[model samples]
Target chain A: MYIADRSGEVIYHPDQQLIYAGLTEESPVADASLSDGIHKEVIDGIPQLVLVKTVGYTGWKLVGVIPVKNLAADIDELQWFGVALLLFTVFLLAFVNTHLSEHISRPLSRLNLAVKAMEAGKENVEFQEEGCEEVQHLAHSIQSMVSTLRHLMDDIIEQEENKRRLEMEVLQSQINPHFLYNTLDSVIWLTENGRYEDATRMVNALGKLFRISLSRGKTVIPLKDELEHVRHYGTIQAIRYKERFEIRITAEPDTEGLYTLKLIVQPILENAIYHGMAAMDEDGEITVHAWRKGGDLYIDVQDNGLGIPGEMLDHLLDESQPLKHSKGSGIGVRNIHRRIQLFFGPEYGLEFFSEPDEGTLVRIHLPALNEEQAAAYQKEGTGYETKA
Target chain B: MKRKHKNLIQLGILAILSLLVILSLFIRDISWPEKAERRVEISVIVRESDSSIWSEARQGMAKAAADYGVELRFLALGESNSVSEQTELIRQEIKNGADGLVVVPAQTEALEVIVKDNPKIPVVTMESSLEGACISVMPDNVWVGEQLAAAIEEDFSEGHVLLVDAAPGSSGIRARLEAAEESLTEKGFTVLRCGADFTVETIEGVDAVIFPEPESAVHALQLLDQNGKTSSLYVAGTEERILAGLEYGVIRGVVAWSGYGVGYQAVEQAASAVLGKELSEPVVESVLVRKEEMYEIENQKILFPIGH
Candidate 1:
């Protein structure tokens, strides 16, 4: 039943029929949604307490009645509280996750960066060590392992490099003694022939070569220094196989700053003089050309003498085999090949090509010397690189 | 009536006997609470130039000596502020056959080499002591500055301040200046800095000059007096600073630490270490005194006798 208190008349009922009972004509209950006193009656009927609030409408009073039992069920208290708690929990979790990730990611990224650097052969970057225990421990372990591996690999490389260097030094020493003996023979011949200037030049070139060779016990030389060595070797070859071969040297201005591993270019030229052109009837020409292309420095020594077969070209750079085919001049070329590869790495090395009855060309590629290297070159001069 | 009189006489006799027993017990306990008969000679080295702190420090040494019933040989080094003089005095103390030495180092860096070489002697240092001493007893300077900074921070939204580091390597002064600078700067303030080995010549272009100890205030006043500039200066330091400020009427505000409190703490620490007694708290304590809260530091004793 529904009623309007102002009109004193019924407004609504479960039975929606216009039925007027005993009520005043001017009663406001006539237009009420429910009978005015029905809420009070219902509260009286139930044992539980009912809360009723009078809500004002535009032209009527809305009596909102709520039973104590239905209040919780209808309002859905747990659902709303659960939603709020869930939202707060989600926010808290998000905050923790962000904080944790930020902490973990920094050290992890540093470790990753360190590992990448090590892989890229940079053994000098220090990684930050912090964060959660597992990550910290992992970082520490990785760092430790990297350190151990780095030290061990460094030792191995150093040992191999040292062995290669010792062998190269021994080879150089052997060459020095032989050249000394040869120079003494040349001096004797010059004294007998009375050509004092040529003898003196020979003796001086030998002294200069050995002085640069033994160079305060170092192995590295500037391109200019190496070219000077080349000139000396050419002098020696000119003295040894006179009128058999003529060597020409050309250098780019910018390529002068490039550094070569000590005694690298000379050995190749020696091989060209002794093996390639010694038997040629006419004067054979050996041209040593150096130029910079992009970031790389290339040195090519080409000789117009006996060309190489395609089959022997593969094993020509191999260090183990002695050069047995053409009076064994491959020893010097192999040494040059190994040195170029060892210094600049496998990606850069000596490239050989020959056309039958035309000529044999030896090409050597090296890293472009940087400012620090130039500074080191100036400081160390020509001494320590061969030793190191 | 006759029985009552007899009972009263017996009660009087019992009361007299109880009083005698109580007196005997009290006298016996008084006679022997602990042994106070160990006589020892100690050297007190003061690195001051006839300043009031030096005088108060001597007074403290005298009190300690009298309480312990020991002879105190006092060595006054330098013209008060010279670290070189203090260094020279330490060498003299070592040479004088003093049993134990107490030195207040004048400079932090100077003591590094001096203290490193000397060993096998019990060296007790006090008052803003840092570097090269085995045992150091000084009030927390950073806390003092922090308290002052926090107080200033409460009133203003932001503050622009200048710090005058009176002594550079004096740990007490350095720590205070650092704390104040850090706190004020942390709260977003522009801080200008200056360093002086002696007195602050001028603070006109500054908001505040934080003097870590009272002696520095005296030096500052002396510097100002020489120029005939009696400008009111806002300063902070020890209880001696509070007293100096009150006497000079130049300081706009005074922040002080309890000298007696530091002394009491040192004594308690020494006693605990001597008698193998456990400490209830950390051996060091610090407090602050501001102008608005001058009552807290007014009547407090600067140095108290250990026994008294």
Candidate 2:
């Protein structure tokens, strides 16, 4: 059964149910059917016209009804076909969804992982770039950005390196002449006090310092020259301290051939003295231990003077800034650390440990070199001998 | 002269007596009304254990045995290639009073001794004929091999031909391969021989491949596929190999002989000999099937009597 209302409302009636149970309510459907200008529905069940304002005078609602048995077969067939079409469309959509997700999600997940790794400061991060244009472009941009960042870091390091060398030059200009002048002042004071042989010995020590320091201005000096340079510096420091600081040099004979960066050991020794001993009163003991261990040349500038506090130990190794509240004015321990890092690598830099007042021990590790310095040390230090 | 003639007479009588003794020993008894219908049993021994050609041959033998009304028993020649089992089977039948035998002998020389023991027993050979058999009915292998060569020459006249066959020591395969080589070479075809086992390795310089029989055609097609290398491969052998090659588009052409016909003819010939009937003339047929023609359903018959 079908029902239609020409009004705005869509009215549906089951004809069999309606006929078996007649319309006992007075709805005026019988009166409007004969006298209305409402056109007949072309097919059953569907509403053909709105009955709200018909051309003929009828109420706002007009109704038409068809029997229930009509069009049932067609409706059932239509429902079945609709369900089949819905299932087929759902299957096709699922297939397309799976395909599209694989294409889009896989590369996106890789990109997400790469970005996460980069954010965590990983150096080498790779991304897959062989998909759609946008993904490929994004990957390419990320790779380019990483490359630029690496290049910028390298530039920053180079600039900081130049600044550090400038500071080292400034320290050297201040300390080298000051040390020479102090040694010359001591020699003058000794000669006026009628200690002529002692003044002559000071002159000899000063000459040895000058010869080892120059070495024709070659940056890499044999272990002997490096040792002699440190010895001369220590001798001058010992005299200035009024013989309160004792200098002991211990080394192996065969290690004279090994080369070290010029002035590396001397600067470390200076840091040990000023930072470890300048406030001391009675006696300051300093020992320079040089030896060859494995393939490396080791030099230790150990002192029994007032040691550095534990909290300030890390500051001694930091190269990003100058040492805070430090009194060694020469191209000090920081310069030595920087030079070792520049020449060999960061791993070969100066390392140290110090307690409150027990002592401070500084160990310098460098690659070993060859025999020419053994002769240079013998010719230079006639009385200076190495323990076998 | 008298002494010599007397001794010759005695020797002739002894020979006749020996013949009589051999006949009595092998002959089985029969019950008859007017004329004695001798119920002589003949055993056919086949070499293979399992094959389609063997099954078809058994079918044909059953049909022929029904037509001739002769009792036929099939004994497997067992797995040994020396025919010792077949010789032992013949000896067992002879002791059991069997009158005649049909044998697919493994070796030609072994058959001579088996036949000599009962000279009058009338041994008919099928597929494998020995020196002493009274009648031999197998595909004339030389003729079949020659037909293959002719078909190949007609199709591909100018390429190097590789002939693949089973073990060359086998009497049947050796004769066929030699004939194929001889016929192919006579027609100016450079014939290269390869054993069935290692045909692929030896197919290096060959242009077209020809195998002697149906059993090894698949292996031949595989070798051709490997050696042909996108070039045209021609196969001449079994229907199964040809069909497979055609299905996979492996071979350009195939030359096959009918296994069923060989089986039918062999049985008919053997049955005719046992029944004292006139033999039907054997027809040897070889056909060249191009890859397209292999699928023509009219030609799908088995082409060898290997089992029966």
User: Which prediction has the highest lDDT against the true structure?
Assistant: 2
DockQ of 2: 0.00
TM-score of the second chain, each candidate in turn, equals 0.69, 0.67
Residue-pair clashes per candidate, as listed? 28, 12
C-alpha lDDT of candidate 2 relative to the true structure: 0.63
* DockQ of every candidate structure: 0.00, 0.00
Please give the lDDT score at residue A140 for candidate 1.
Answer: 83
Candidate 1 on A6-104: residue-level lDDT in tens? 443323322111112111122223224344343432333553332222345534444333455665674565655555566555555655665666677
Candidate 2: count of backbone clashes, pairs at least 3 residues apart or interchain: 12
Q: Note the Cα lDDT for every prediction shown.
A: 0.61, 0.63
Q: Show where candidate 1 strays beyond 4 Å.
A: A1-167, A170-175, A318-331, A375-388, B1-308
lDDT of 2 by residue, A154-189 (tens): 865674565457445733643466676877899899
Sorted into a CAPRI-style docking class, model 2 comes out as incorrect
What is the lDDT for A295 in model 2?
Answer: 78
